[model samples]
Target: MSAGPTSFCGIELAHPIINASGTFDAIAARRAFGDAVVERFPFSAYVSKTITPAPRAGNPPPRLWEEPAAMVNSIGLPNKGAEGFLSTDLPALADLPVPLIVSVMATSAEEFSGLVEAVSARDEVAAIELNVSCPNVHSGLIVGEQPSETEALLEALRPLTAKPLIVKLTPNVAAPASVAAGAEAGGADAVSLINTLKARPMFAGKPWLGAGSGGLSGPAVRAVALQQVSDVAAAVSIPIAGMGGVESGSHARDLLDVGAEVVAVGTASFRDPLAAERILIELRGLDPVAASSATSEL
Candidate 1:
């Protein structure tokens, strides 16, 4: 019973299972599985892939490289851009059964501001998830890597809309808790974390991925995510949507034990598109209240 409902940043959800941006595609899912997929959607909220101000073809080639416990991706945030997203993508996504969170990224503050303003204006958007992986030109640092940069970006965009602002944090930083604290200081409603670890693999004296390095994800990073989630949860009072190596209900519960209000399935979905549903079912079968206190996080 404890698993049936929850509220996140003012939006009601059937459950806390959500997919990582770029991991699950609802429009494509509906195309492949039909309307039933929408009626029985796995996630309570649908997060669109990161869209920039203009269209991008993505990296040159060989963007994905599989590893023992995970995979690396340099696929880049290939998308149809802001204008294309609002016109072409938003219409179809609006038909989903749950709330829609648009994920956006830009090279500059003004560009990011434009994205937040445009997406927030849409009737279909429930919230905006700012992917902080972008580099800050003024500080010569990536937004997720620097606490000050994250705070400044959030400060600039917070006034644009009343919708919830969920900052997606990168796991590359030494102390992600600081970034989460900064995000909170700048008025973020919540935070989704452990975007991926920077990694590179080589084979036969050459890099495996077409791009020399990429972000690593999957089961291997779960421990790292748990630690960071625990740290960030301790650092900020706002809700947290924890994600990294989530594959099953037990894994989701683990994140919840560490104080994540929600858990996102990433690499596991590539293997089983319906993994989220299975995870949700498993999660519901357990006692959510009993599980929440199973661990004392670091």
Candidate 2:
């Protein structure tokens, strides 16, 4: 156990500070910081990068572009397929000092089910986070964009395993609360937000990212995240993992005030791999009891 330990979706976490799915790469960190980093890992829970049904080569060059207050990335969710992930990445992540949440994305409900079943079988994975950014083959709308679609997807995968399923919400939606309601009705253990907003930039008569459009993250999306987190919290009673431009404890406090049960450190980790520890210290300084209590219940 660690200081200010709490629970999320029945999993005991050392603290409320966890990494967003694709933000902090623990394997890379270990290579850079060695055993010391793993000995005092920053996050109470570790979320692995998103995995897909099939291997992805990723987008071409110019994958990441720095902006004024944030960054735009068109990395294209590149990763080894499910089998490769289970064989390679899973073993490497199992030894981390915190519960692990595996993130996955697919193009269809059946594909999503396959991913859910496969990842849930692993003992190291405490939960599964659906990166609902992939487009649905039938509706053509992104899974996270349509409330009905989200519910239907959840209904299909709910029985696949008993492991907790978390739906990662997209901020680029008209009614995030409604979608959250759907997830609750379909049996989601928790919900996280907001997956970067769609962004497109031009320079020298050319688009910035090779993929033409990218997702913008960092401080620029903090306000949007707060509004969305509050809306979803009001709509659903399940645990909420909130994040967006969380650079300090005050920023994280805002998310909790708006009803986020756990706060995930994302973009800021790019600048400081140990940013979560600093944020947690600051968050405790504000109201240690309140911060600990948020994730302590349910």
Candidate 3:
């Protein structure tokens, strides 16, 4: 048996099965599923969706489209933003069974740093997962696409944050592993990845998603996720939070085997909100109870 508890950035997780941010909405989900949802929170830690400086209505209509064995989304990180997140959302999610990692994004490095400082002050926030995959409005360079940009962004925010800084990398890059290395060079405590492959869906001879392009996620991306995690883990010294298409215990274990420290369930939660819990149960079954209860003849 592994000697230590499944953890990420020193936060002990009851299990490695954590819900991917944007995929699981704890408060809304609880309201929908009631006690059933509360019974199995479906994650070792809860990650809030991307928060910005102010509220957003999100992209126009038709933000989601279904494809075979996967889903495409251009929801555009629609959220209540920082002030509303702290005042309204955090309080409600304060009682999650595990730590709360807040995911944040912005248009510039300074904005990213500001968001980090704001969320870092919260008592319930365990860590800050910086979404650097988005295109930077100021320079038009995705921080995750260029190693230098990622390094600079991390360097700017690292000093402002005491909590673990997790840089979420975009899979749309030519070499995500090199980007992950850049994050580590700038003092990122950990990294999470395969943040949705850039994709588009078509139906009835028309674009299926409102934005014409969305991040593709689900079972279809699992193999790519595994490879990226493996490459990043080999390239960096920090822990990797492997995510993308993990939907079951075997899938989670496959990630761990590939050097992922924690497995994040994304699209699976959309289909079965209880998938994380089910994965945890399956992981628990891998070790016999006797491993910890072997009788020693004195």
Candidate 4:
């Protein structure tokens, strides 16, 4: 019956509104909005940008190309690496009032486990979100596509860290629910999805993004996101953090109405940094129990 506040995987979030990992940057965001970022901080819990084991230069220039309603990005998860994040970026973001969900990706189970342990040791980190949806450079297969691979990855990474492990599922998979089931079976504390789909576009007779193909996100994928969230939520027992093309409070509620415990705002953040906050306010006005109960019966 309660709706003002909610807790996901034991982390008490002031509201269900949160940013999708790699979407909002609290550091750079502060420079633009100044005092406003500290005052409201759009997301209830800030999910850090995707961090890798080593430094990455990322894809070549022209990494982002704006489309009509959606944008294509092949940034390739560029970062200063985990060490830099832990030392420099993290300190800058540590003082924020909201919980921090660190997004991490690695090539193998061992590397993933190491990252989990390292990040888990940090007191500022509230949860560890594993980005297993990335199409591996070594194995053409995506980690989140196969249930066996997803389960194995989680099993290896879970034992190395005590912090809550939230696996980010891939929408490109055959059966999104089976992937979520794998995460739960492997002891994942929670699960989130669906990451952007692999997309390709040749804008005006030339390749748009440098990588040729990039993950597609924005309002264009809202329906796919809803279906994926509903499918995964039905298959898993753990809490589901659902997101994709959430642009409005009604869009956020649509995901929640499908069984998502929490909704993440992604592309919308770029259009309106205050979008998540607005959705939170709107969500507060709705009846959480009634909405969830109705969805469960479907």
Q: Could you tally the backbone clashes for each prediction?
A: 0, 0, 0, 0
Worst 10 residues of 2 by lDDT: 289-298
lDDT of 2 by residue, 165-279 (tens): 9999999989999999989899999999999999987889999889898999999999999999999999999999999999998898899889988899999999988889899
lDDT of 2: 0.89
lDDT of 1 by residue, 179-199 (tens): 999999999999998898999
Residue-level lDDT of model 3, residues 1-298, one tens digit each, is: 2212566888887666777889988999888877666565767788899899878888886899887888889998889989999999998898766799999998898788788999999889999999888778887987789999999898888889789999999999889999999999999999999899888788899888888888899999999999999999899989989998887777887888888888899999888877776776666556455224323210
Query: What TM-score goes with each of the models?
Result: 0.95, 0.95, 0.93, 0.92
lDDT for 185 in candidate 4 is 90
Give RMSD (Å) of candidate 1 vs. truth: 4.3
Model 4 quality (TM-score): 0.92
Stronger candidate by TM-score (3 vs 4): 3
Give me the overall lDDT of model 3.
Answer: 0.84
Superposition error at 6 for model 2 (Å)? 1.5
Scored by lDDT, model 4 comes in at 0.83
Give Cα-based local distance difference scores for all models: 0.89, 0.89, 0.84, 0.83
How far in Å is the alpha carbon of 283 misplaced in model 1? 0.7
Worst 10 residues of 4 by lDDT: 289-298
